[model samples]
Target chain A: MSIPINSSKAIFPGLITREREPVNLEFAFPTLDGRITPAEQFYVRSHFPIPEIKAEEWRLSIEGEVEHPFILTFEELKQMPARTVMATLECAGNGRSKLVPKAKGLLWEQGAVGNAEWTGVPLHLLLEKAGLKAGVIEIILEGQDEGTISEEPKAPGTIVFAHSLPLDKALQEQVLIAFEMNGEPLTAIHGYPVRAIIPGWYGMASVKWLIKITATATRFHSYWQTLEYAYWKDLYGKPTLVPVTEMQVKAEIARPALQEVVAAGSIYRVTGAAWSGEQVVEQVEISTDDGQSWQPATLLEEPVRYAWQLWEFAWNVPPTPGAYQLRARATDAAGHSQPDTHEDMRRTYMVNFVAPVEVIVK
Target chain B: MSIPINSSKAIFPGLITREREPVNLEFAFPTLDGRITPAEQFYVRSHFPIPEIKAEEWRLSIEGEVEHPFILTFEELKQMPARTVMATLECAGNGRSKLVPKAKGLLWEQGAVGNAEWTGVPLHLLLEKAGLKAGVIEIILEGQDEGTISEEPKAPGTIVFAHSLPLDKALQEQVLIAFEMNGEPLTAIHGYPVRAIIPGWYGMASVKWLIKITATATRFHSYWQTLEYAYWKDLYGKPTLVPVTEMQVKAEIARPALQEVVAAGSIYRVTGAAWSGEQVVEQVEISTDDGQSWQPATLLEEPVRYAWQLWEFAWNVPPTPGAYQLRARATDAAGHSQPDTHEDMRRTYMVNFVAPVEVIVK
Candidate 1:
């Protein structure tokens, strides 16, 4: 193989593509331009085909358990007081490819995430317009994308997609019925016309190509919605598995491509990104001598309450050529960092280990 | 605006296009078959421009602070002894785009990371050939890409570009004088021809377009090496910044698209990615009621020590239409979970807060 010698100025944000579930993959980005991931450079993660929703015909219906079940056109939803939020939308399997023993999903090595200034009407606003009825505890979200559900597994298997959330989350002010991304109308690949913006949650909860809403008293069960995405175990060597719902706190280094050499006599800056589903990062520390010592890093200020934070540190050249170890630790406001190992956890789907970098000085 | 109804496909790897920092863009990947990110789909992150180093012409000079300054060609380096490793290379600021208050740097929102099998001669193997000298405590790396370090910043006023690493880090067995990625010759965007593989550290420390390596006893500095990439903070109410050097523990949701609507009575799966520097993930927990509670998630095994882990969870729908809150938290073997805030910490750059998601059930 020949080494590429030219660095193209092509716009980024189109993240590394990988296989679908059971084999997805993500890559570590090397740029440290600490700013918004330009619309042209945001990562993309699609499960099926990129849906192309028609903007004019898009109609969001607010029905089901509400006193007022009304269907609103795209224009109607857009006119209901626009709210803008700079939020980060990440794929639940953004870094699946880097897992050990391999995984049964996309082999992503990072890059399945993106952040944007989303503009839309609040879901609460629409919920309020529909007029909620008492005893309405669950809200259902459905996408226009369709498939089939089967009792037995086939090649593609039978799975229709649908998800539901408790009424409390729908009431949050930040929950938005977004129609635009980065100040523009949603791209076809993104949930155009209408999509939910649930800040701080895994991307799985956010349905694309939204179509219907139904209110019920029981629970929901769809193959794609439940069976495939949930966390399950073989039941101590059995074939029985369970479901998964939330997210975890994790981070990654964003600079220095692996196996690349640095000018032996020069200095370089180290940077990365971090986020969690339930809390904000409290502090980040660095260790150059493996885990023997640690140092605090500088955290960048963020605009939204439920968003990831940027971090940075500096490293000078070593006086001799040898081997070195790199490690970073993050402490949330509640105090959390990566562990030395995760042997005790049973379901090995979400691995958030303390990151360590090993490199050569010369 | 109208919603474009279409199918979503899995993301491809290695096929991403490069863009300016703070990238925000979209891509419609065409897949031959429905596979997870294939090796061909993997993206690449190359610091500096890719180099055109001919195997015969390329010569590695290890001088300064060494017993005997030695120079060897690629053939010579390979002849000494060959070692290979399966490792993951990550960028320091892979998700920097998610940072709030929007810092002035690359606006990467994930997609800046990836994992691959690497083949190369270990740094130790090369060092044994050159022979280490006394008083050399640091290793300075310089790439072949030629460009003046202009005082003028990419922004109105930003730091220059130069990078460095410690000798100890440079000599790790994982650290390699790599020439291949994933069993193939390096791609241009990846360090083609020849590059260093410093596993476990930020991508920035692994300078691309290799040209020079020097052993030294004094601190090294460069545009990207010293001035830029370093962290700063208030030292006793004063602004103090330092260079970034290590990786952090972080995670991102991958499966669900934001604002997705599911049909009532459906089961949904939630998935994402998690990782840290040096430490392994112990457990990943998800919450549906903000931070009030959390449940464990299914973890995915990884091949390399520095790679990210995939996680999944399944949720059953509540028959009623309402709102739901989604959250995820990762615990390291050291017993750390996501944080609720970052306010308590004196520093703010490395925010590893647990992320939260809001979903509307109706």
Candidate 2:
């Protein structure tokens, strides 16, 4: 059978249409403003039809390696505690269109990422309330979404969207069971009454449309974890397939868009956003003359823990008119910087390479 | 250093810029007319700068595994004999932009092909005059153009543009050593003085800028041959590296233009061209609904050996206003039709798969 692609026809104002059935959308990067992406412009990634979910009838179950297996109504969970954190959520396959070998996946451009303020109950509070038993290793989160994968690395049969996080990471203060986005109630398209917001990792790790959570005594290996989202990680020259976990340091140009034309000798504000996994972005460099030379761009604001850092460069365009290729690179506090080319340790995932935006200076 | 791309600043009425240093040009296929592409409209594939050669001072050397290792002046080569053949010349990587896994090479669209009437002397006549040795296995053709390779599978150092043909293939009467193109003396860019016209083979095999010919006893393995133009051919399931040869059976649509709009319920004449390797095209099929259904297109003229066969389809359009995808499929006398998808045998080359031309009826 011909492999299925993200042929979604869904569209939203100020957003780029990506896929339809599940309603995937992309932000119009060049039109972006400020740090937080508008709710209507935030990218939507769905694997199955939006479930007919209702907040009044919903319940969350905490079971398995726990002292007291229990259920909490949506109201009960929301009444516990409310905390908000600004974070960047990026699809692991964000820059899929640029992958070499034309790898299969959603042909997402540079808009598959966005920064948002999420408000929800701390996951640790619920876990502490349920009381963990001895030898708990990981927490498996399953969503209400279910569908058959029709692309490569397909499933054997019907499958549910699920992901597991190591218990140590799950106990962090920032992990949340989000029920609100940007201070507003989550929309039906954005996982409505419940979702897991996992900061510092790819969006796939944060299962949406949350239904149940299971504390396991051993490391969990879901099909999505081992097959599709996995990439070849080299260990001493040997390629090993490992699950893609974190978002590598990446910066993307948002102004003077690809192939945009500007008058010669004009002062243009070249601005963009940069983000990294676990570590905060510390520096961003811009190259106006392709990659011949580079200059540091000043950060618009101080770096945040889990949010994207915005940067800008004021260019003094030369009088001569010609085509100029612009590119940006970001480095995190941990010293991880975006690579010029995708190393062999990739297969349509973690494509945080530096992308060029060619503009015609006329 | 990064390898050069189609960085040419040259612009013509309708020709698409491909490469600058080599002055490679691509035809705007949708605006094409008639069987023979105009001289300026013909696709030009150059490996290096147009060599500086004067017809009064130029000479072609025929040597190696032959009794007469002599040279032929431009006037001598032209006075011997002249014949013209309307043949199709394709860049092997014509549909390179659509290759999956985002393979690297040229990101050519569907314009790197055209049919031209080549005028030249039959190569067999010159070989007979130079009496070949019994051990000769191949005829090596070299052009005067030279450059250093900086791309993947690059040459170890500076290399000349070269290719070789099998002994039997070289003896074919259709192969030509030509000094004229479209009834005019060859342009420096197309190949001045004399160049080999290799009918039925990919353009790379038809080396440009004629300089010398060597009849070799051993199979030739030039860098352009074994390293770049080679693809992985599967024997059973094991991949074996093989040299890319003749053009594959394929068809492409030209009319209605891509994304062109027309009045609803109008009678539309969809036209295009189809060609194959040695086997002549026998049939051309049209799909108006994106391959779900297909109808045979009327061949405008009988198929010709090594030349593109023009085909047209008249459709009574539906009254509804919507977008429609148009694609063409061609089959040769050998029953080889364009594959729906590129099998694993491809690696940025031999991208002769069926391509769609989407149009809108408003």
Candidate 3:
């Protein structure tokens, strides 16, 4: 039976949306305040309607390349010691709206990302209990939410939203089967009862409403892993497909919002947040005069692994009143930084260019 | 009738407090995430219980040194063009807890500061409508909430929370008569119908539940301004008293909270926020190994006029496991930076000293 999609909740009061059916928080809301996006205001990106599963009846199955395939009930899973981590989840197509010739998916602005404290048992511990085989090459996680992928006729008619990680990534100590978000039980929209928290990866890699985990001896290819969520690049005049996995470094202005007006000769505080998927953000710089000169913004708080860092800069408005452009760029510990312009890719999966916010000084 | 102080509503879920009879939002909640503190989460520093004023009956009186002394109804006030500003507010006794002798009143932590988007008519526009007199010396703002101060038996039995700003500051366009906060009408606890937003002054200067604005021919010296908020200091062995007004530069770490344990050899982001009352923060440096060496932190956004700017630094945990001391200091536009230790002042009003956050690595 198909789960009914409900969009009547007012959890997020002023959430902007590109698509209403699956629900998406506008790019401006999360950055408006605080660091951890409250669970109620956490962004929801679902391909299909949410599935309702009774906690008592819910069971997670571990099959395939395991020496002992087993099923664990929700209560049984909770009996283990839980680890908590603050991780940021961003849609693969977060900045697609900024791309020219607009990308064909959910045209998200920057609001497609949020950081939350997740609590759960480590996936590696569960994997160890399952007794993984030496030849295992990949681990596939499947969510209960299922729907027909009409866009891909060649794929199975109906399949669960699923993705796979290489054996090394799947066994990382940071990966977890999360049951709580921001100190509260996960809401239905955020995968109640159980979900997978794959730190440092795009939102797609962390399957919600998780139902099954399968260890395989060979690389697993699903519609999401092979057909969608991958960027096609022209390398030496040849098409090469690369899967969108970890998030690239990006920054966004939260206050003095786009097109905001300020009094001339007044000092205004400009602020925003920045994040990198797999590595810590090393630096974030703000350019008030359209990149002609750059000044460093003070980073707020200690960076947590898999969490975005908040940043700020002080801009002295010129005595003369007119339009001014503001831009922010972030660099990660991996030595990757945002480029000034968008890359020419076949798909707009990760648009990490330095987008300018225009402000008028009156 | 005395205004009733209601605590039935939980606007701030985790508000730390020194007194419950008169509400006060502790200093740590506002820096949790984002830039603007949400209306519900905005810190409250109230002396008397919130006065319940019917919106229809509420009137703001503009009297004293003006050609035309007039009263404005709520509707009339809303008819004027509204100006929105993201300003930071902090209690004058914010760092009183750090005082050695234990300063009188609330022992607030760093959470007393918050940035909010306030919307209302500019004070200058309203003053223009009132037609200011040629020699107006001060603008006195009076809130409706009133209570007897046991500490000042020589003063009036009942006194309203009142303060005055200089003529130049009162006429500044940044000063606002705010009625809306964070896109919603103000709550009763936050001065519902009207409150003054003095961009760069201490929270006392921005009187809440404001009902009167008086332009005085002579300097207005209220108990709040002259006796309570003033800091007694020793200048050349002579006792001198100075009014607490603008905020001094301060920095506080917001994440990996104090005494948090971190994994060794892991990359962690160390971040915090910094602010100066009237000037912009010019620099913020972080020292992981005490004050021996310092590295510049990346500021996240442009420095706001009266709001704190978030900052970050990537801290690479040393491979060996042990305790680490992290310290952050800020410098403002005037070249006035935070001191290594607290100033030797008789009163603990403004404490702008570098604070170290201790953490253990395992």
Candidate 4:
């Protein structure tokens, strides 16, 4: 299926992309200024053309291990007690462009992450209404978007976008069946009728154009869980694949953009944002001399559980003019911090390295 | 005369102000995200309605103590070697709202400052081209904006906006006759065709809607110089006025916004911007224990003279939820730092005290 170029263009004007087969659009750094990005400028990563669904005709079905299987229409979902959350969403393939071994999928930069206000009905409330069973181990979410996975050509076939979440995560109050963004109805390109909003997890977990919810008695296995979004690692000289889940700590400079010229002997402000999926960002440290020395940056405010926190640093320019490498690294409450480089990764999936930006002073 | 509400509204949407007669529009903190603000969104502190001038017909005349008195058309000005500089502009009465005794003029908050990319011909180059004569003491710049200053009801009359610059300042390479903002032609609300850009000084030093520049052999004094922008100080039991020139060291928090709610047990990022007028901001420190303790914040990059440098600190939120006060203080190259309070000032103008922002942890 051909990608809808007109719809993508109208919504994302300056979106950076590497291919059009699956329609992957990366957000630029400038648009990531405020805490919440507008729906039109939000990043889009799809494995297939967006499916057209009429809101009135669409229904979300809850089945499997639930005692009382139920279906909810668009209007019924909105009628439930609405909860709003400011959550930061990041793609599992973020920072893929900086991977040394060359990742096979979309080469995404640091713009794949964005914090947005999502309003919806909590998944736990819906699950409560449906009466959950004791043996439920996982819940599977299925989206209407369907396409063929050609990464393994031998096993290529038509499949819908689906992912499974642990029972505990699915029961969290933060997880929601979102239909609104920034207090307005979601745009057509951003899952018009309904979508799953899984806070503190990779974007793939929050399936768009969601249609079905299934409670399973055992681990839900799928190609998305076992192949596409997993990270390949060397386990005791043998290869192993681990499923990507909560985001790792990472930071990026937004102002004094890459290769920007600054005045010599002048004061310049370095500002950026940092986040960790499940853990709160504890600290953000900046290095001007290539990691030789580091200083703590001011965290703008108390961080939201699933939202990125803004940070800034005051730099007094040196007397002489020259090129300087600036880098920021974030540490989370779990004691995890960004690595200096992810060059050793064989196939990039969770590339959370601290990328350096070069700036010239003259 | 009624204020031009339409023009002010178009230029400054979230401008905080007291009255509209003199049109005192302060720059809001949220808008100070990137290095440069958009032209339309830049703060407007006009004394009169925006003057409509045809760029093609406008001419900048250089007269007085120059060997070659010449007038350059708008096109001619653009043809000169264009230099783009990232500089910050701040009103002299930036923190007037925080003054305890209360200021006489407009009560401005911390949002009266913004950094921008200005492109134009260097003023020193123009001075050199005009062939400066010996013994030049000052240069007078006159704008086409005519207004009446009715601060005192007894004294009210029409006057043109004009200011004089010292010979050394006028000859500095950093000064420019800017015709563009953020790489675009100056907006009608932001001086349009041409305006003077004096770096390292308050915004009043930059005369908008430029018409003529006169080199003088002696100091030139005007109402703006001797009265309006001056600070009243008591010298030996006698009150005297001192002209406000270079900006004092000031620091303000940008994120977490004023009175914002933060999450408990979540690590919060404290971010803010700091600047010095005549000196470079050497360091920025943050205090969360109500002035009981201070910790140094990381300076992101070298400070740009006359521009605000962004600073940040990683603050681990306390486990318990409660109200906390956050304050940031900046130290300049001259060992000068922001004062804790300026309550003793008779009439507030340069209130560069360290403003405390209260945030609730919940």
The numbered model that scores best in TM-score is: 2
In candidate 2, position B146 carries an lDDT of 85
Candidate 4 stretches greater than 4 Å from native: A1-13, A153-156, A233-239, A343-346, B1-362
Estimate, for each residue in A1-362, the C-alpha lDDT of model 1 and write its tens digit. Answer: 11122231222344454654312334336553544555555655455555567878877777777888999888777678978876665666555555565555555554665567778877878788888888887677777654442222211222224566677876777777788787777766566667777776666666777766666554443333323454433211112223344445666666544444555655656666676655777777878787898887677655245566777767664767777767777777657666765422222344556756666667
The CAPRI-style docking tier of model 4 reads: incorrect
lDDT of each: 0.58, 0.80, 0.78, 0.76
The candidate that wins on lDDT is 2
Whole-model alpha-carbon lDDT for candidate 3: 0.78
Model with the higher TM-score, candidate 2 or 3: 2
Off by over 4 Å in 2: A1-362, B1-12
Q: Write the per-residue lDDT of candidate 3 for residues B200-292, one digit (tens) a residue.
A: 888889899999998877645465754467554432222234567888888777755677787899878766688888898889998888899
| Predicted complex 1: CAPRI docking category | incorrect
- What is candidate 1's lDDT per residue for B1-362, written digit by digit as tens? 11122233454433445463312222212221221223454445543334566667877777666676777777776676667765544565555544554544455554555556667878766566567777666676656654332221211122212355677887778877788777788766565677787776666676665655666665453434323454433222212224456555665555444445544466676666666655667678877676787788877664236666767677665678776667777777656555665421212234457655556676
Q: After superposition, how far is residue A80 of candidate 1 from its true place, in Å?
A: 0.7
> After aligning candidate 4 to the native by TM-score, how far in Å is the CA of B189 from where it should be?
84
Output the lDDT of residue B209, model 2. Answer: 83
Worst 10-residue lDDT window, candidate 3 chain B: B1-10
In terms of lDDT, model 4 sits at 0.76
TM-score of each: 0.45, 0.50, 0.48, 0.47
